[model samples]
Target: MQTRVLKYFLTVAELNNITQAAERLHITQPTLSRQIMELEKELGVKLFDREKRQMHLNKAGVLFQQRAMTMITVLDQTKNELLAVNDQLSGTINIGMVESAVSDFMMRAVQKFQEKYPDVRFNIFDGDGDTLRERLDQGLCDLVALIQPIEAAKYNYFPLPVQEKWGLIMRKDDPLAKRKAIMAHDLYQLPLVVGRRNIVRDDITDTLKIDLNKLDWRVIINLPENAKQLVLSGKYYHFGIYGVYQKYHDERLAFVPFSPTKTTGHLLAWRKNVQLTPAVEKFIQFVADQTTHKKI
Candidate 1:
């Protein structure tokens, strides 16, 4: 089957209108229609249903769409790799990173990498570790920096020198803030403000054996800034890494490291056995070296 036909099919399937897809593809309607017809005949299946001048994908088309998307992604990635091989770090690198890593390691690494390869571009997506991992697995990001280790077999993980120390963030006047180190049980008594449950909460709670249902958990925030805001209000306490905690170390907020049981490690991950281009290789080395030197 011709790749062009698959491309035409995918465009039509996405737009659900031949005219719109053709216009978007910068091809005339007749040419696009012919390509789609040829694909249908070659595949021996009707990919779409026509009803009242609208297009709806049939069951086969739905399945084919998934495969076609993967094919296109692989083809695009191949093209990029080839371009990168020409000693031009000019292509984009999509990165997903947890909130803490964004402030701690990612910022420095990206700054240095950009300085070294000014022609290279970056697309950053910041979220919790689990969300970052999900984006990495779905091919949405070229790499991910996570605070937690990824146990998935498909991913190859590199431990950064920066080990994350969990901390309890609260108002300076809060009783827990006066303590040198906060215990997990101490957090249970306060109204806990934590990031999304799936991302950081469950892992920390599981490690500490803190029952979420039994604790005075106040809010489940998804953004790092929101967690900071809540902790600064003096009513709620947030649990996060020192990197994030340090961001709000003003007079209104105080952060104490959570007792040793709560600390987690940071790691970088990408698909196993996948060949990385020179640009990505340089970035990986740069991150490794920076983290090692900073001892973060």
Candidate 2:
């Protein structure tokens, strides 16, 4: 079968509605239906059972879909590899970055990589560590950078140049800002604004083990900027990695490192076992070199 026909079939299978699939593929429903009919005729097997307005995949169709999806994935990867081999580092790199890393580190890496290889393109998605990990597993991102331990065994990771530390960001006038270091118990007393439950939060929670009901936890915002704004109002305590709050540390905001006796946050990650393109490999090497040099 033609690749185009297989694509159409896959699209239809995904939506399970020819009309909807047609709209997605930007084709007429009649044309899509005719193509499917021709495909079934050539294969000598019924792929779908149409009942009024609804459609369901037949046994053969279900099996075919499994194989077809694998084929499509391989073909797409092969195409990307071929393009990369042709010295066209022009394809997109989908990256999922934690909010803290995006401000300085990720942007610097992307800028430096793009300058050296101007043809390379990028698409960045931001989220907490757990969300980033989920996206990486779902094949949505080529790489993810976050501040959390990677527990998955199927993936490999390289450490970035920076190590992160957890901190409490509050208004300059806040009484807690007077302390050189804040403790976990101190945080528990305040209305804390933290990221949603992710690896990072889990680690913190596991370490703290404080009663949720007793703590006056306020809103849980996703982006660091929003959390900073909330903390700047002098009513909430923003709890996140130091790097994320560092940018906004000014006369209005004060950031105090969480007491070492309390808890400390670290940065690490896991990535899918996909073949790294030349550009990706180079970027990885740069990160490795930076990390090693910093250690020295």
Q: Against the true structure, whose TM-score is highest?
A: 1
Model 2 residue runs over 4 Å out of place are 1-79, 87-90, 101-103, 205-213, 261-272, 294-296
- Give the per-residue lDDT digits (tens) of candidate 1, residues 190-280: 7877777464567777777776777776787766776676777777877777777666557788778866547677788888777786777
Residue 241 accuracy (lDDT) in model 2? 72
What's the lDDT for residue 195 in model 2?
Answer: 80
Using Cα atoms with residue i matched to residue i, what is each candidate's TM-score against the true structure?
0.68, 0.66
List pairs with backbone clashes in candidate 1. 162-296
Please give the RMSD to the true structure for each candidate, in Å: 5.1, 6.3
Worst lDDT run of 10 residues, candidate 2, spans 261-270
lDDT of each: 0.76, 0.73
